[model samples]
Target: SPHIVLSTLTSYCPRSPHIMSAISKAKKSADDARDAAAQVREVLDKIRSALSHHAHDTSLLVRLEGELVAPANDVIRMKTYTETAAKFAGHLKELSEKVGERIQLHEDTPASQRTLNVAFVARTKRNASQIKAVLCQAEDTLDYLHQQALSSYAEVVLEKGARVIEERKEERKEEQNRQGKNQS
Candidate 1:
């Protein structure tokens, strides 16, 4: 009797094209978001590595100063990756919202007449939540890395400035010594 009822409901209730299109878009967005997240993770790892190396050796900061100026450096790459991931995340969020609206529409249907399986709806909700969580994490990581890069750049400038001041002081002392000797 339950099987008969399910068959009758399935035959009578055709799936909406909008719901099908939303599902297709959600799947594609999820795949693209995953790829973007992976790229951002790689950028984060490179930033961590550079920061760790600089921590172990102050001279590495000088090297970082040069790398920062380069076009293809980790900081620049991280920015690009993070931007791309953020775009994908936003798109995915929109798609998930559409899917949620479709699910709500199905849930509103009378129990005996509902075409969507309860378990299927629950699983879809869980998947959307998980994808959002992952993308949020990637964005957070990118923000942290960007901050680190800024801090590193500031330190390098300060170090260079202090060195210049010391050199000028040394030059003044040498000039004074020469003038005194000549007067004597």
Candidate 2:
């Protein structure tokens, strides 16, 4: 078969051993960089998750405060901050996968025994910088989301408190009317 013959010839071809070695080193470096970036993304995801949980807790706290005097229907409202944080985390995860896939480790890599290590180090630094940039952007987004959640929760608590005061006033008015009717 023509295809079989070509495949056999290509397999038997004597490639430069030095070039192969260089390629292997570069591949290893690229893989390491990709792994590092993935780890950084994971850490950032955890940070975002923690922030979301805090937001949830804050909302819950506001709800508890409302329970002391506010009507059941007027209790604090849970804000949408946690969901936003989750979305951001998901985006970061997708980005991490893309970065991992883009890391190309090929056979044409320079020889590891020589100055190739220096090149590898420089490339690694660049990859790290890119990862850091992505993380910074994620942090900024999460911060804004948290702030919105906090404000929403605060507003709910205030509304609940106001509703409770109005209810108390209505009760007092009804009590005064009942006493007047009894005297008549």
Candidate 3:
């Protein structure tokens, strides 16, 4: 965003509006990206809250073939996805902060001290676009993880219910055999 401000002070091509237009478009993209990152943060916070509660309760869920058949495992998987999302958001946040520093550096230097270059401006725009792409990927990953978690929870619930029914059936059969022997 600072680049947007700085460019207004020094337009390399005085009559060319193309650079200004590109900067405007890139600024809008960065703003959208920042909003997307905020949404991701909200999701991660919820996941962290749920994960903390269920992580300790993993022992309560069913186990099959020595594997954890539990929603906690699903939440754990979701956490990994959230972590990747957080990483991209953090990078974007850091890059934006750099703009402030760059602005300060530009201000401290006299106009005659340095020439205005468009390459840095172009690089900043590219970084914003790249960060936006990363945020999009993060959103997609979160959605996929959410779907997997719902399916996994249902599967674990079914397995637990089935195991309970099977155990009861065995117990009842044993009782009936003992009763028959007693009656005989």
Candidate 4:
């Protein structure tokens, strides 16, 4: 798991729409990326067919390389991101299990058979301590997963930016060459 078996956030989570939306977005992005990869594969197959017809064509080969490499890299990054998300979900499930345990132990206990005054204080303290332990574990798990996801995204963005910069540099150089040839 990306994080540990983990801790509980609250006794009752009550299904936040924001959390659901985030999960949906993550799944959608991975699916979209997968679809993009499929399209890229089709493009490569066409490139291959074109190259087969013209064995000595540098343009087709260049197009194949340029088209395949970036998307291939992106697919790898998306795989990592999705795997990390799955780990995060596993830890969250663990947390939910812990919360359920807490509910069984405390909230469901018969109130008529309950402790009073100092005893109540002691019980609360014990419950608090147990909950705190669970929460601390959960906090660490979430923090670590957050760090990993952010790092993955940052790397993807940086790699993409690097590729774009290189492509733009090549374009500017070509434009300059074209202008020089016209001037001459």
Which candidate leads in TM-score? 2
Instruction: Give, for candidate 4, the lowest lDDT window spanning 10 residues.
Output: 2-11
Candidates ranked by TM-score: 2, 4, 1, 3
Question: lDDT tens string, model 2, 23-103?
Answer: 344334334433433444455654344334532232332333233222211111213344654555555554454345224
The lDDT per prediction is 0.44, 0.43, 0.43, 0.46
Q: Candidate 3: how many backbone clashes?
A: 0
Models ranked on lDDT? 4, 1, 2, 3
Candidate 3, residues 1-184: lDDT per residue as tens digits? 2543434323433343454454444445444444444455554444333333432221221111012113223333333245644544454444344434444444555545434545544543453444345445545554554444444434433444455456567878999999999999
Best candidate, lDDT-wise? 4
Superposed Cα deviation of residue 87, candidate 2 (Å)? 6.7
Q: 143-164, model 1: which lDDT tens digit per residue?
A: 5544444444344334443554
In candidate 1, stretches whose alpha carbon ends up further than 4 angstroms from where it belongs are 1-115, 179-184
Model 3: how far residue 149 lies from native, Å: 2.7
Q: Model 3: residues >4 Å from true position, as ranges?
A: 1-131
Clashing pairs in 1: none
1-184 per-residue lDDT for model 4 (tens digits): 2011001111112233443344344445545554544654564455445434643333454455456555444444455556643543454445345435534544444555445445544554454444345434534443454455545434444444455456567878999999999999
Off by over 4 Å in 2: 1-42, 45-94, 105-116
